[model samples]
Target: MSVATLSLFRFASLRSRLWVIGQMALARRSAAWAGSARFVKLCGSGSGVGFTPQPNWSVWAIFAVWPDEARAREHIDRHPVFARWRSHAIEDWTIFLSPVSARGSWGGVNPLIDPSAERASRTAGPIAALTRATVRPQFALAFWRRVPDISKVIGSDPKVLFKIGIGEVPLLHQVTFSVWPDAESMAAFARQMGPHARAMQAVRDEGWFSEELYARFRVLGTAGAWGDKDPLADALAGAAAAGRRDAA
Candidate 1:
């Protein structure tokens, strides 16, 4: 089974922050990650709901796809670049994911393997949805104009456990990741006749993105913390409680 790991690094000092910035380019050519995985990307984040135009230099992410959990864990244990990043980061977190469903292409191919494709009816667990896009230059302004409303909607959504805007490029390439209690809640948010729906419609009508990908994952597990706590703790606890009640 293929596994995906999204590792977030938070640098506090100015020097450490500058080093991570340099790694954005150097890490690409490093032997550690070079040809070492099914896919790899170094990403920067945005401010506010992570949708704004301004960049958040202090936080960066390493997203990679591996053959299995063993290989993924091995790399995380011994990869020098990863170790260095963690050494500098005041805080960091990594989440392991197994694709439940994925469609479209990213950088010309969808790197995730949907292990549950044949039997993926488990919409009861924690669900993470990732959407990535390469915006066309002509439609950049128009696309961004619609983001604030979408961001606001998700930001205030009580059911949204966690959400962030991360991307490869400032304006040209954008990615959004969000976690929902279940698939139904996620679908409700996406399909509701509101800003998200309207913007999605505009994308189809305007062809705003040259390339796009959408993938959903079943949360395997996590290491470390975000904001000093696992963002999924409450959600997972609720799911566990619900399961126990059903068994009782």
Candidate 2:
């Protein structure tokens, strides 16, 4: 199956941050150089969990999709664009993920192939979810008005291993990514009756977005750390230990 990778870069100084920010447009050519690349995106992060309007100049990310893990790993290591950003970053982390379930569209179509929901449910590991949208110009205010509450809701969830607000365009195009210990915990939050649920209802009733995509992933592995830790380490380790015991 196809795989996706999200590589995050953290910079210390204002100069480095600005330089990475400029890569949003500048790095496209280099990213396109990959012969087998399926999808490529350069993203800037938000303050806090990424819902706020203020940009977090210190952190930036690159998201890509490849045919498989080996090719994805190869490109990220050799790609000049990624190399340039890493050279300036004080810290960098990359996590590889496999899609379990996906719906709707991303940039007109979902680039990654998703397995059945049943297959996703059977997999025992850390779960990651991605929600992306392009807000209709007319509903931009109403759309943004509900973000802080959603951010607060996710931020307070003890079950969330990692969460961040990242996007392509500053206001109109946005994406939220989060990691959970399992599918059950992740689904609980999505079904929780609060700002997050309310926003989903509003989207269905009022149609605030012109385009959207939602997907779930299984954490395959990690190459580096975020906030000085591999956020999914303990949970993933526990899952692996259980699997080993069951096999024996």
Candidate 3:
């Protein structure tokens, strides 16, 4: 089965028009490149809803689909655009990749974001980092545009390591869920010339999306699965699972 890679980012210092501009340039270019590789189907960003203050900023979503984990790993390991851009841009990068086991609409299901709900999401757990923190009833498509489709004509062949599902949550904003060999490998990529790093700089420089970003990485157990493999469902389920201190 194909897996999903979800990532969310929160930038403490990302609150300026200049940063937004820089992010745009990077996103347009990155989208063009990834589009050529046939890895990304949709890419966009926006602000928070139903939540207060919103995050300083968030990387709304960076989602893609791949054939498998090995392919996804290889493509990420040897992407030219990523290698070239990592030199001057990007800093303080962190990422999370969760294989989605489910999918569903968060517009009405979330408790914290809903006006009439009991706020069930407020309950805390051990794996707090792996659960939903911020809640958005409806996602705002604030910064979005096209970079054209010249990559396919150029014949830039690229493959994916895993299939990805995009999710939107208030706390874990700008999330990307992916399956990697281990947390160590995921951490290494974050430290090296990874797409997350490149995109971070791009967003900071050109302001690709409307919000800032914050990410976390977690390993899945046999019982760990996203609800209906939906990104939003996966986030909620993951959050709940992370706090399961009694699981065997």
| Whole-model lDDT per candidate | 0.80, 0.81, 0.33
TM-score of each: 0.89, 0.92, 0.32
Q: Which lDDT tens digits does candidate 2 get at residues 135-174?
A: 8888788777764457677888999999998888777778
User: How accurate locally is residue 131 in candidate 1, as Cα lDDT from 0 to 100?
Assistant: 81
TM-score of 1: 0.89
How many clashing pairs does model 2 include?
Answer: 0
lDDT value, candidate 1, whole model: 0.80
The true-versus-predicted C-alpha distance at residue 76 of model 3, in Å, is: 2.6
Which candidate wins on TM-score? Answer: 2
| CA lDDT, candidate 1, residue 64 | 90
Tell me how many clashing residue pairs each candidate has.
Answer: 0, 0, 56
Runs with alpha carbons beyond 4 Å of true place in candidate 1: 114-121, 146-148, 238-248
Best lDDT goes to which candidate?
2
Worst 10 residues of 3 by lDDT: 125-134
> Which runs of model 3 end up more than 4 angstroms from their true locations?
6-20, 23-61, 90-100, 105-248
Cα lDDT for residue 50, candidate 2: 42
- Model 3, span 113-170: residue lDDT tens: 2223222322331111222222222323321122222212112212212222233333
